[model samples]
Target: MQILINLDANHPTFPPGTLDTRSRSLMETYIKERFFDNLMYHEAVQKDFAVWLEAHQKNSQASPKGKRLEIRKIRSAAEKGLNTTTLLGEMERLHFDARNNVPDKQINFGLSHLIDTDFLARMAKQAGNPDIPITQRRGLMLFGATLMVGIRTSEWTTARLISDNPPVLPGETAAHPILVIQTAKTRKVDPEPRYLILEGFDRGALGMIEACIEMTASMTNGHLGQLVAGMRQAMLRVADSPEAFELIEHIDMRTARKVFTVESRRDKCSPEAVSAALGHTTTNNLRWYAQGDIHCERLTDIPLARATLNAVKKVRDPLADFNERKQLAGGKPLSGYPDLGTDNPNADLDNRGSASLANRLINPQGNR
Candidate 1:
């Protein structure tokens, strides 16, 4: 601003603090009305100034050389800063006194990079190259998915990867999927119980996890901080770019949970069932997942409604929130459980007619 002010009329800068209230007001008015009325505002301003100067001409004999400049520098600097549209604000309130402030009074922020689907697809294709090696390539997928999952950085300390698995055998027609999760976040899933049907391993998802376990087991740097440092080095070898973030940010647990939530909802599983499958303390953890951008095409085609009920029934009775154990136990509704449309519009009459309220498969006829 000071530099601009010091410049001559045809110079690079304006004269410092030389602008008075009248010129400043007119300059602001010029900026505000120029686009709407067509850019005749500068000519209009000069004409108005001539009229004003006519009245002053009789009272004073001052030269045009002494005239002070104000808004020129401030407006010029702001335009240079990419805040070109700031003048589009409420001009009635944003009046600035040029004699008091410098042109660079405000800071300018740059534009942010956008996440385009085309770019993501390109990155995914690059990730799919066979020469990249399975271990390194799988790491990128986990990292990308984890970044999308958006877990808070503070909780990374005690985060543990859980697996509910009988370690999917070499071949089996009836295998449950492997569930990977954080332990402190959920104690609902039994630590000792090993039960899950392994899902497909197209992206080397399971292999990467196995590799991580093996690496940590062999490395003497097993301490949390040391492990973090070691993983950073390993990530540099794989990512090879300045964009690779911290190793923990690449873990896929959160993404896997998001996948489950999307699939559960796409298949229209009840909140209770998703809660059990996710090992959540309540249905609240799903709130974040529900808000995510999950494509319907990516949803697993499992009958979540039925599978959910089966899973829910296996949970121990007399849970913290679940009562009416007798009704649900005998496949009947107690006082608490909603029985069909009699009380709640979304109640299950079919389930009530069947065996246990807790064991009910989705009552399709009911308002789910």
Candidate 2:
């Protein structure tokens, strides 16, 4: 329910502050110790080279050239990624036994995982319901967007969202109003606008959650700053009230932004589109570590709640699809009196011979 950061049913019920600290530690340690150690498998296979070097360092007369040949042979053998896998396998055999026990909640989102449309649809379904918890609402809205849209966690910040109401525009249509936004990272000169449709939007569901955000914003009078802070508080609530939801993240805002980025790319948004949607002007500007982009699947991949309803009317109306059909096909004459037997259409042979008999019909040559 808390989106990326989930509660471990098996873990002890630590206080909010303690739970927060542990979550941060786990996210960090899991990456460095488990993930990186497994990821740099080739390097892990060569770690004994360091120990061998240390031994050589102790005895300078040791055949440095002989050691090089042995190293070359080992390197050749290592080219087989199976040897690399063996490093991970060895690590698993050694470290993954008792330590195999991990937290019940998974934090890391793999790139392949975002294709789960069911997962994203579930977020919308859960949030579409008004009775859902405020804490759950906070997490799903942002995380759902990240998962569905493919954004980087690092770009997520206090000032970027408005949990209460979307940013308003002048003379904008009531159906889909454009929201003005400034980039949180580049802080570009001119702010850009994004249009989001609220028609058929589950306002009953979203409005209830916004009420809490509005209450938090009212604590401050200034509109711009209060809007951002309100969003932050709501997200923190989404993470779970530090009092109720077990708030986490000790590293810094930068780390949290990274989390946003990772989850977003996981949602399968191409890097370019995601960058544009998030207010980044270019992909080159993002750090190499950031989830750059993902390819989109199809039109069905995006939300079309109201538009989909419009498609239903065609099923009942016979002429509902008339715009796409050719309506004038039947008006053609039967080919200008077809006696299509002649190779040259104007031969006049029938008139030359048959006029003798037909003359009786026209003039009654011998009788009338």
Score every model by TM-score.
0.35, 0.29
lDDT tens readout by residue for model 2, 1-368:
12242322346456556657778888879878855534445543344433444355347655645544444444445445554643332222222222233321122223223224553455366656677555455545544443322233332332223334554334334434222233354565754433222333354434432443343333433432333333344434334234222322321223234444443444443334334444454444333324212222221243321111111111111111121111222222121112222234333434544222222222211110
| Candidate 2 segments whose C-alpha is farther than 4 A from its true place | 1-115, 121-133, 145-176, 187-271, 285-368
**Poorest 10 consecutive residues by lDDT, candidate 2:** 305-314
lDDT of each: 0.38, 0.35
lDDT of 1 by residue, 1-368 (tens): 11222112345234868887899899888867764333222433333333344355336555433222223333444344433333311110122211222222211000001122443354466566676555455445443333332222222332233344444333344444443333344455656322223344333444444444444343332343443433233344444334433322442334444545555554455555555555543444545454322212332322221222344444432322243343333444432234422334344445554344433433422212
Q: Which stretches of model 1 miss by more than 4 angstroms?
A: 1-141, 144-173, 176-182, 186-190, 202-205, 215-256, 267-273, 293-310, 314-368
